[model samples]
Target: MANHLDLEEQEQLDQFKHFWKQYGNAITWVLIAVLGSFAAWNGYQWWSKRQAEQASAMYEEVERLIGTGDLVASTRAFDDMKQRFPSVFYTQQSGLNLAKAAYLSGKPDVAKTALTWVAGSKADTGLAALAKVRHAGLLIESKEFDEAGKLLSTDFPSEFGGLVADKRGDLALSQGKSDDAAQRFNEALKLLPQQDQYRRLVEVKLAALGSTEAK
Candidate 1:
């Protein structure tokens, strides 16, 4: 009876060994792939958190520099921060601030550069669309009529239709197309919600343009 038990145990061990020999490498690799992916995911989350913290600190520094009203120093600091973390939320916001600062400082070229960078970013599509709209306005101010027209004609998301139409009207006005401008502004009025203060602003523009309906 003992000999019979030994034979049975040996047979089971042999069967297991055969099975392992046939699939050991594939099983090992599958486990490694699964575990490796989990580890990589955790590492990426940690890295992203660290980067965001660093970027937030850098953005605060840039804000301090801007607040000092030292345009040259602020611009340099902003440049450095953007180079390091172009896709970070803080970096994107800093770009918008820099654009406003530069434009207000009569540095349209620098402002355009900042706005262009923000507009091109894919990290935040909503911010990017806002940047594009602002950039189009600046281009119009610069009398880059063709470029402004092209930018204003963008197929913006539905939520931004009113803003886009308003911009298009501005572009038309810049090009001396008053009738077209009125049409676009009226379109904006229809697209914009009644409660949106921006819609009131558009109404003002339409009134100024003598759109009878806007009256």
Candidate 2:
């Protein structure tokens, strides 16, 4: 009876060994791949967090420099922020700040340059459209009416369509294209909500052009 029990135990051990021999390599590889992927995902999450923290600190420095009216320092900080975190919200915000600072510092060309980059960047479509509108206005200030019109003609976010139309009207008026200006002003009026405060301003513009809203 002891020998019979021993033989049964040996048979069970042999079965386990056979199963291991058949599946051990595949199981080992699967576990290795899964663990490797998990490690990579965790490492990426940590790296992204660290990058965001550093970028936030630098962006704070940019704000401080801007508050102090140090254009050079602000510009430098903005450059650093853009270089390090171009996809971050702060990077796009810094572009706006840089444009405003350049304009206030009597550098219209620099302001236009910054705005143009923001306008054309693929970071955020909404921000890009707004930047294009502002950049167009700056071009108008430079007496580049045709260029301004071209910029305005470029597509924008739907929400900005009214504002862009109004700016185009202004550019047309400045160019002495009265008929074109009236057409654009009409389009802008249609886009503005009836109860909007700015709608009254558009009405005034239409009145000035000897045109009245229909219906």
Candidate 3:
């Protein structure tokens, strides 16, 4: 009985060896691929988390600089944010906010610079359209009518139809085309929701045009 048991054990060992010889390389490669992919995924998760954390901290600093009313410093910080964290949401947000603050603070040049950056790259579709609109407004302020016309003519999301029409009206008005401006503002009124506060502003523009049709 002892000898029989030994023979059975040896036969099982031999079978295992044969299986290993047939499939060992294939199993080893499969395991390596799976482990390598898992490691890469984990590493990417860690790296993304670290990048977001750093970007959030920098955005806070940009906000602090803006609050201090030091636009020069704020612009510098925003530039740094854009350079280092271009893919981060905070970078685009900071650029938009900084541009608005700078424009309101009587620094249109700085606003234009920031707007140019945001509009040029187009990170988010909606935001990029907004940047172009505001940038076009600034160009109108500078009486660069042709350039503003070009910017405003680009494709915008469907939701931004009213805004684009309003800007087109403004551009037309700036060029002393009251008839065209009135037509554009009328188009804006149609595109805008009845309850939208912006419709009121467009109404004002129409009224100012003294177009009896608007009444």
Candidate 4:
């Protein structure tokens, strides 16, 4: 009986060895790939967290400068944020804020540069649409009618359609096309939500057109 048991144990060991010899290398490589991917994912998470934290701190500084009414300092801080954290949400936000501040400070050139950057950037689509609308308005103010028209002609997100229509009205009005301006303003009013305050402004513009036919 002892010899029989010994032979059975030997047979089991031989089968295990044969299985290992066939699949050992494949199993090892599979484990290595899975472990490598897990480690890479963990490293990426840590790196992204660190980047956001640093970007948030820099953005706070930019906001603080802006709050103090120091346009120059705010602009510099925004530049720094752009350089260091260009892909961050804060950088995109700073671009918008900086454009407004620059415009209010009588720096139309600076405002245009910032607005152009934001409009053309890979930021959120909605934010980019907002930038394009505001940039078009500035161009219209400068009497760059053709350029403003081109910008407004680009496809905007659905929520921005009303705003884009309003800008087109402004463009037409600038070109002294009162009939076309009234039509565009009516289109804008129709697209805008009834409760939107901007709809009231569009209504005011339509009223100013004096036709009373545009709804």
The RMSD of every model to the true structure, in order and in angstroms, is 1.7, 3.7, 3.2, 2.3
Q: List the residue pairs that clash in candidate 2.
A: none
TM-score of 4: 0.87
- Lowest-sum lDDT 10-residue window in model 2: 86-95
| Candidate with better lDDT, 1 vs 3 | 3
Model 1 scores worst on lDDT over the 10 consecutive residues at: 206-215
How do all the candidates rank in terms of lDDT, highest first? 3, 4, 1, 2
Among residues 3 or more apart in sequence or in different chains, the pairs in candidate 3 whose N, CA or C atoms overlap within 3 Å are none
TM-score of every prediction relative to native? 0.94, 0.76, 0.82, 0.87
Q: For candidate 4, give the lDDT.
A: 0.88
Q: 1-215, model 1: which lDDT tens digit per residue?
A: 99999999999999999999999889999999999999999999999999999999998998888788777887898889878888888888888888888888889998889888898877788888889999999999999989998887776778889899999999998889999999999888888888889987788887888786542
lDDT against the true structure, per candidate, is 0.87, 0.83, 0.89, 0.88
Clashes of 3: 0
**Candidate 2 lDDT tens digits, 45-150:** 9987887788778878888898898887888888778778877666676788789888988988878877887886787888888788889888988999878978
The lDDT of model 1 is 0.87
Clashes of each: 0, 0, 0, 0
Candidate 3 accuracy as TM-score: 0.82
